[model samples]
Target: MEASELVQRFVSRMAEGQPIHTASRLLDELREDLIKIGRRSAFFESQGLPLQEAWVGIKFGEIMTFDTIYLAAKAQMGFDVVLLKDNVSVQFDITEATDRNVDRAEEYRSGPEMIVEDSGEIARQESLFEKNVGNRLKRKSSDNLIVYVNTGWLPEEKFIEDALIRWHLSFKKKFNSAYLLIRGSVVQLAPELQKFSNSRSRENGPKS
Candidate 1:
């Protein structure tokens, strides 16, 4: 199916209360389609560059992350309803996912970050997840953490190692999954996430 069609179908399934796994699979397909589209953009096509080269364009961002997670929650978790309070901005976006039957609500805060060059900057991202992990663990109702990192602009090494480490050690268990916005695609940090990272590390090699 086309990317747009798949996206609509995903939203429809969420509204109709389909399985979260099913919705997530559709989104996984959607991400691939989007990457294909990015490959065809004029800049990449004209230069005969790989589709991977076009990932830093405007189409890739954290908004894509929210759509995947929110839809999955609506279908998978008991969150039958969702509310969007505002447009996504540089600061952050707020969303509320609620299961009225259980009187439970999860407040999600999501935004995009450019992984910093200095390792010290890792603390900034970790601090955000750390605060939310505490709340998520204590709550039976809602999971309050959602973070999306845009790695297209990162140096390949930082993209693979530092980014994966932060997600694996700190955010993985607490958030179910954290989204990584890379190469103009949003991916759940699944098992394949590590495999993909390792391959890229090999391809990029050590810095001169």
Candidate 2:
């Protein structure tokens, strides 16, 4: 079938009550596009340019989603993912009465722990709200074409570790140049992704 015909059918299937089946097929058809996007993004990184700068693409998800996709795309393009956290002021003071850079330690300790707590609480609320809204919208949209994007260049591992340490007083797992996701269409692409590069050229297209 033509790409236009396939898209229409997929959209129609979504409008009807066949989301599961339709979305699965639509993903099959778009897998090549996704992989191409991933590969091109990787190539751009080699030149120290933004992935989006090197290719034609669309932003499908919110900030968080985009962040995850960027990492995955980077990996697909053969690059390491680095996580960095800034504005983390650690102060210590070293006096005759203290050992090992006590002044610097004190400086780091002086930052707004309470402010972190307050902001964390708010973030938790917002995250919960976003999840609920996302799930509900997922259910409502028969097409099931939800996209999220996070453009902030915060280091993923550091961000998680710092957030956990600050809010829960604990450390989380470390990540390096990898994509991690909890939900959305991208997850579905994993198994069949190896063929994603040639997906658009498949004769039968994506199987229903």
Per-residue lDDT tens digits for candidate 1, residues 148-188, read 23222332444345445554654445554333433333344
- List the candidates' TM-scores in order: 0.27, 0.22
Candidate 1 CA-lDDT value: 0.33
Candidate 1 positional error at 10, Å: 14
- Model 1 stretches with alpha carbons more than 4 Å out: 1-146, 150-152, 155-160, 190-192, 195-208
Where does the lowest 10-residue lDDT sum fall in candidate 2?
A: 90-99
Looking at model 1, report the run of 10 residues with the lowest lDDT sum: 102-111
RMSD for each of the candidates: 15.3, 21.9
> For this target, which candidate reaches the highest lDDT against the unseen true structure?
1
Model 2 TM-score?
0.22
Which prediction has the highest TM-score against the true structure?
1
Clashes of 1: 0
